[model samples]
Target chain A: MQGFALYPFDPPGDIAALRAELRAWLAVNQPQGDIVARANCWASFDADFSRALGAAGYVGMTLPTRYGGGDRHPLERYVVIEELLAAGAPVGAHWIADRQTGPLILRYGSEEQRQRYLPGIAKGELFACIGLSEPGAGSDLAAVRTTARETAEGWRINGQKIWTTGAHFSHIMLALVRTEDGSERNAGLSQLLIDLDTPGITIRPIIDMAGHHDFNEVFFDDVLVPHGALVGTRGQGWQQVTAELGLERSGPERYLSSHALLAALIDAAGADPDPAVAALIGELTAELWTLRQLSMSTAAKLAAGEDPMVEASVVKELGNAFEQDMPRRVQAIVTSGWDDADDLARLLRALLIASPSFSLRGGTREVIRGIIARGLGLR
Target chain B: MSAAREMLCDTARAVFAEAATVGMAPIDNAGFGLLLVPEEQGGFGGDWGDVNAVLQISGVLVPGLPVAALIANASLQPAAAVSLMAGAMGHSLALSIEHVNTRQQFGRPLGKFQAVQQSLAVMACEVRAVEAAAAVLAARLDAVGLDPLAADFEIAAAKLRANRAVGVVTSVAHQVHGAIGFTREYDLSRVTIPLMRWRGEHGNDAYWAQILGRQVAGFGGRGLWEALTAR
Candidate 1:
């Protein structure tokens, strides 16, 4: 096993050029409006914005050019997303498909599947959501009760997936279900690329406490799917999903979720803010830089085709903690009371409300700790 | 790892293991002092990453020895060896984990307890943070030779994080070990004491945090983010 040595964050010249290009494009195309509107970050949905991003060749950056992508490295994609998140661009509509689904399809999808989905995904015309978490199976996905039975024509699916982000707006779902019954929790599971338009599939929005309709409870009631929809081999859903998480947990989104809020806080704290407040900002900034380095290292590993599951988990665990802690720390620093009308106060309010989901989304705090413990051979 | 670095790490590990049992005096003969000196400068022209790797391994193998400090004094500045100190702190953490895994209480290993697990988990995270900070600093030092002013914030941040980590790690490691860790008979003090001492050597968390605070304040609110992501 290779030890966790220090990897340089020096991007190639082309990657730097790509960053410049992306910044130029974002300057011209990104929505210009209230700072609070950008607070949603990855959760903010705008189809036209996503299409414009795709048109600029920023969406499917890492996929092969043969499939309408930029044929760039994952590090290039990292640079693009870093800029996007830093600018608080609304990328929610194409975020999942661009980030994970496109690459996943290219890797595991058959020629037919890839030809059918990858181009649309690359074009940013298709959106995707994961179907791993069921009603009782969030972190413990092996307990998934969703079943997909093989039929002569295809496969029939039945089960409910809870907290499925963007499922209502998605074109497809890479559903994980039990294709065979067995004693082993992970043995019989399989991944199915289910079309959201398939018969008997219903996606009902679950309004969050903040009144955001991003989360949905997707019901699969005898939904029919073709045999080709099965991704990879049968009984390999666990492995596939675990592999997918390396991509999921290793992105800038993990730590940059509340970056807009941090930027807002800094902007609000003018040049001559309180010394104590400045110190707090410095500490947070240092931590953010540290986390970004860790994250970029994981991206480097991914580019080298390494799983880095444990390292990715580390990034998510720490990144989530930092993001969730941002609002409270900001609240503590900005001692001068600002009314709700103040943008800084409004951003802080939004973050405080949404910050609780930071850890809960990618993986819960307990689950992440458990993963870290297992990685350390403690369990 | 380069062939030279691999050989150096293996040799250091073996020497540190022997030194751990015999005494700290053998560390001078371990060839760590000559690690960072350029070949042209009558020393091994080793990479900073390779040197830091040895430092971390040395930390784990023989935490009591001031071998890393000696290497730091020989290669970089007295205050610049925080990365090596971080490696030493990691060794202390590794020692604690080993102790907790083997130390049984009430017919079970102490690691089986949730409280112990949580403490160790937190320790592991701190260890990771220190490692990350140190790695970033090492990379920066390697890319551009250690100009103290250019790398001031990074060096300070690494030291501060490592210093803070040592406090948490030692507290938890000692907590997990109970009274034995505090005694001289047990080897845990070898690492814990040095961690406590080394944290105060370059700059303690409070000291560096104040510097970093002033630096950030100087950058103002908007300039702070730019300062952080400058690299």
Candidate 2:
């Protein structure tokens, strides 16, 4: 919190041209879907579109060329993802694998794991889900009761992971499980790269309030994975997961997930809007600009190999509030019918229902604020 | 920050410390008015980055002074005020953190309480956001050679964002300090009062909002994204 400096978001090798190329590609290739799908496009799954994006060398931009990746700079990857999100691309199919699992594996996974998973992930063919929250551990991630026992044959796992996003569609699960016999809390936990196709694995859909099957309840009934499934150190899952979250919490996705609504609102307002509408647009723009600065700086810090956990949390906290507030504020100012068919009305309706989950997902608002408080040395 | 800016900040801190007591005489004598003037013309050849850093210090040490007026022209005041507000809000957050960490309540430091922690976290986010806004605004100004019209979007956005942060930073800073922060003798008032004043000084919330909103509207929906990325 001291000497807050804006880390320069200087991506290498012709960023403007890169943006133009991506925009041109998206113009020709991005799927024409339901207008509402554009609001939270990350959650809009389209396997073909993802494959096309990967073919265009957009996915897995940061991984090494040895693993079938482009070997681009992390900031370059940041630019591509932000552009994808802002354009409302249906990136849901391979989002998790591309965002964290690919990088995490390249950083910590074994050679065999990288050889097996990295190529598929880079090709947008292998999807992944995080196995963190359970029925007993929502915000208290350390209260995980999931267990995986090492044996002469393999690691035997038996657990239930609730609220697991993309589990139904994912090819793998990066699971955090208790490994030590009597360990409690965050100790002795390990991350395992479990293939979701294993026997005794079940992924049941859990429909969200928006009527979208974005998350699921995954059950592991004596599922056995090879000993090679272990990622990083044996007992360092908490630290690894904490580092992974720094990647998760800060990104353009935090703010631009609902960018379509703002775009639609602006378009609907026309050139000379009413004073109230104009003022609302102005405030939202200011917030969006400030958030871009914060998010990019956090991304820059992370790219420089610095741990930006607190700054990441600050971006998450503020980005969540902005995205969450956009709809309610629009509702307050605009006089649109609930069941209207116009694009603005439809977007407003969709975002009003979707905004609550903005703060709740990734991390709850309270949890994020607590992290910031700790960063401020208040706790 | 560059080494040159660090040195500039050091000079600013020393001059502002003196100017805090006597008037703007020390700031004038130190030649801060010539900060943005070209070095070939016998001036510092400073950029907006220099002004931003110097004003932040001016905000923390001498918020009552007209340092921004001396350094920048009338048009750039909004941007200048944003840096000042960022500095003042950061100081308020720092002071509040110190007070809560030291002040005991319920047989424990106030900072230990989740309620106080949450409030301060919110305040900290506002402070950090303003700091980021001011920094980016400075970069944009420097990139465009300090032309106000060229950097209009950044100016309005940064000023509006800083203005909006004023209420939250000042309120939460005082809330965490209890009645002690309300006193004239306490240092909290120095920053909080000026933060409140600066919010309304250079394009308040509504002022910048309408201006930015209309500009964004002119960009249309898709054009807004193009403009933002292009800049």
Candidate 3:
């Protein structure tokens, strides 16, 4: 809560060449599909694009080379991530795996777990989904009732997880389940990496307001997996999950999700835009630039082995507001019908529906603000 | 911050504390104007980073003084104003947090209330954003060898961002402080009023927005990313 001094984002090697190489590769490999898909492109799933990008050594850039990663710097990975998000790349497929799970596994997973997951994750062929939110746990994640009991055969799990993004398509789920019987809130929780195809497990699609099946309601009824499925130390799931959230909250994705809309608006406005459009563009650019600086500094702090929980929360809050407000502000200023099929119109319509979930996802607005308040030593 | 910059800030804080009551005489005598002067010129030979740090202290202690004007040129005034605004807004947030944690209502400290905590959180976010802008702008200015034209994009972005944040930062500070913050005798206005004035001083929202908008428009849509990353 002291002065928010920015940590310098000094990545190793030739960063300019890195960006250039990636841009060139993307120019050839990126799917030139509908422009609307590029708006919140990170959530736009394209397995092919992800695989190709991973083949180019972009995925899991921070992991060790032995794990099929490029062994690049975290800031280097950050640069690649920002470029991908800014370009509106369809990075949804491996987003979770590369972002948090891969690193988490590398950090907390046993050698066998890392050997099993990291290579596939680094290959971008294996997909992972978060299993934090349950029917009883949304904002109050500690209310997670999912239970995993150790048996003679294995660990048997029984519960339901709602709002599990990518679970329907994921190969595995790193879940927070109650492992210690009679355990209370957040006390007996442990993280278990469950293979989604385990017996008695089921995944049902939860179509969003936008009519997209990005999330699912996953049920685990007597689902049993090997004892090795446990990740990190038992009963440290709460700490591990909170650490993972620090990675999830503050990233280029928070702000750049709706970047395509801003780009579309600017492109549609032409070189000599009207004063109003110009003002709006200027305003958005200023906020975007500022958010980028904040996000990068947070990433730098994280890379420097410092816990920037407060700074990360600040980024998520501001970045979410900037992104959520972009569409509404554009809709108010621009004269575009909701049903219009043009790039700008369609993007506006899509994002207007998608914007509400910006603050809702990763962490809700209130929850994030509370974290900031606590960081201020208020609680 | 580097050791030199830390020492520089130490000097700034002490001098600015004295200059708080004596006006700019102490600042003038202390040679803050020579901060950006080259070492060969018999001055303190510092970068924009040093200026940013010193001006931030000036903002917190002597917001009414023309410390920014003395250190940097008119071209850099907008960037300097951002540092000042960042410093002032941070102080305002610190004041709000202090007020809420100390002031009591309904038999409890205001900070214990969720509503008050949420407001301060929002205020803290704005303050942090401005601080990041000021720091990045200083980095850009130093990277470009203090050339205003080379750092034009950062200058406009930082100033406009700071300008836009003034409303939230000032309002939240006052709201959380209740009536005590509004009094002239209170120290909140020392930073809040100066923040209100500095917002329109360098480049107001519309002014920087228009200039930045036109500049970005010229960069084109896809070109904007290229230009941003290139810098």
lDDT of 3 by residue, A235-310 (tens): 9999999999999989999999899999999999999999999999999999999999999999999999999999
Q: If you superpose only chain B onto the true chain B, what TM-score does each candidate give?
A: 0.85, 0.98, 0.98
Each model's lDDT: 0.79, 0.93, 0.92
| Number of the candidate with higher lDDT, 1 or 2 | 2
DockQ of 3: 0.88
Clash pairs of candidate 2?
A: none
Residues forming the 10-long window of minimal summed lDDT in candidate 1 chain B? B72-81
- Model 2: runs farther than 4 Å from truth? none
lDDT of 1 by residue, A336-370 (tens): 45457787888888888999999898788788777
| Model 1 alpha-carbon drift over 4 Å, by segment | A1-3, A10-13, A181-184, A336-339, B10-36, B57-81, B217-230
* Pairs of colliding residues, candidate 1: none
Better of 1 and 2 by TM-score: 2
Q: Is candidate 1 or candidate 3 better by TM-score?
A: 3
Q: Which of the predicted structures, 1 or 3, would earn the higher lDDT when compared with the native?
A: 3
Candidate 2, residues B157-178, lDDT tens digits: the string is 9999999999899899989999
Residue A172 in model 1: shift from native, Å?
A: 0.8
lDDT of 2 by residue, A249-295 (tens): 99899998779999999999999999999999999999999999899
Taking all chains together, each candidate's TM-score versus the true structure is: 0.92, 0.99, 0.99
